[model samples]
Target: MMNACPEKVIRMMDDYLDGEISPSEEKELKDYLQSCSDCRKIYQELTKTIAFVQSVSHVQAPPDFVQKTMAGLPKESQRVGVKRFMRHHPLMIAAALFVLLMSAAMMSSFSDDQQFSFTKQENLVVEGQTVVVPEGQTVIGDLTIRNGDLRVDGELEGDVTIVNGQYMASSGVINGEIEEIDQVFEWLWYTIKGTFQDAMSFFGGDDQSIEE
Candidate 1:
């Protein structure tokens, strides 16, 4: 029978007995407990119940508990063993395949040269450009040299055409006709051919002789 109802103080007392009150609230409970008998009684009962539960809830394991559990299994079973289970779960399998493909590509990049061969094809040489035909080369389609210099020592199964450029064919055979823009190319061709021919004729005749 406290003089004041002390509802807020009583609330703090309940929270404190349950260990739910903060330090400030505990101070309030202390001040109230000094003057309140009914709240003190409730707090003492809650503290006793909490202590009893904590004292009885924790227990030590019996000595024979583990042995009793182990003894429940069969002793003479033959195939209770385990093997490695490699679960090729979808994501891991895809990652493994991708790594393998990248490794193969990296290895192939360091390998020998990759040559591209196009058979039964044409050779088109551009103007002011130098064309080189490798040895044992053969073209079945028509060859066009447009204002360019071509060195054709390879075999061509079809015609060879030029437009205003030089054609230096050395021992290669053309099975079809050879066409050109002869009006413009003829002057360049004659200039070069005449210079070379004059040099050769001068050496062969008495006009010029090779000196030691």
Candidate 2:
């Protein structure tokens, strides 16, 4: 699609779409666009892509997603085509990012309260979706909190891991490591490990494993 137009015409087309072209340049682009069917088709597709992404994919953006995604916009002068395409299609990126983050939050396993859906040991506070380790108490075993946040105000003698959640620690002491999983890939890794932790352990996998 990019090679369908002459390089100069492609640059003018991008400038025209972005409304940054001078009046004389605008006239030149308009005349070329009128005669170039391939460029016209590409323009229409770009307009449709923008319209669909903006109108259909109204997303709740993740924190810092805009800055991170915007920072990825192509900048190399040799990649003007890539830069133009990414610049005009930012809503698409936002929609995809929102989907990934939301999948972690609203996934079925997290929504279900069944113990098999998640994992935990005794001697902890459970309120709605959150799990809390009260101050002055100590947990003897590994801790896993799924689809919810963990407030750790006590000492945990074993590893602390969370899936699709946040971990907040207070002045309490934890003798083991802590982890937070906010992405689908990490969640998948935990799910697989939880399902096969024993089998993996038999093959030399460490005892430090995700429960669910």
Candidate 3:
């Protein structure tokens, strides 16, 4: 009706019932509903459901519960001081600090220059170099690279491929194929480029040295 699909109109019912539909659409729907008996019935049912659900939310808590609970808490003059609060909640405070630090580290990782994520390889390894990936990341699918080396310290769900150099996994797992080329420089270049990129990304800029 009115060049609008039934699905779209149904989905917009929530918005329309709340009087949130734009004026143009409201007018169009109203005009269409005047001519469409099915849509009018659907609208009436939806309105009834909304009213019934809202009415069911009329509930009350036990009498004087709030007042009795407040009576048990110490008055402001007898409340624990800040020093006592810290002394009694050391573990909670430390846990909060740890969460804060972890959150900051996660945010910093987005800008790290040497940032690296495992890439999926689709082919099997024939002949290539090997390198190792460090711990903590995960790869979800098979990985194959031609003329490249890989080291695995993280987890992989796919096979691996190296065309030339070496592939070493001190830890982490690979579930797929790996293939690569056979060149020492390939590994070196990849390592160097990846390192700098990760470093920059994590640290936020290439202008500063490690000491800075």
What lDDT does each candidate get?
0.58, 0.69, 0.59
1-212: candidate 3 lDDT, tens digit per residue:
54344776665665688878988888878887888787788889888988899889667878998999899987765334644554677567556655565555545543432333334443322223443444676756656444356767677776665544457646667767655645555555555565555654654542253223
Q: 16-100, model 1: which lDDT tens digit per residue?
A: 7677999998987888787888767766877898889888966778999899988997774433231111132434543554555
Report the alpha-carbon TM-score of model 3 versus the true structure: 0.30
> Residue 168 in model 1: shift from native, Å?
71
Instruction: Rank candidates by TM-score, best first.
Output: 2, 3, 1
Model number with the top lDDT: 2
TM-score of each: 0.29, 0.36, 0.30
lDDT score at residue 139, model 2, on the 0-100 scale: 72
Give the TM-score comparing model 1 with the true structure, all chains together. 0.29
- In Å, residue 79's CA in model 2 sits off its true spot by 62
The list of candidate 3 runs beyond 4 A from truth reads 1-5, 71-212
What does candidate 2's lDDT look like per residue over 40-143, in tens digits?
Answer: 78878877887787798567879999999979997667667655554677556445545555454446555452342235666788767777778889878887
Candidate 3 global lDDT? 0.59
Query: Which of candidates 1 and 3 is the stronger one according to lDDT?
Result: 3
Candidate 2 CA-lDDT value = 0.69
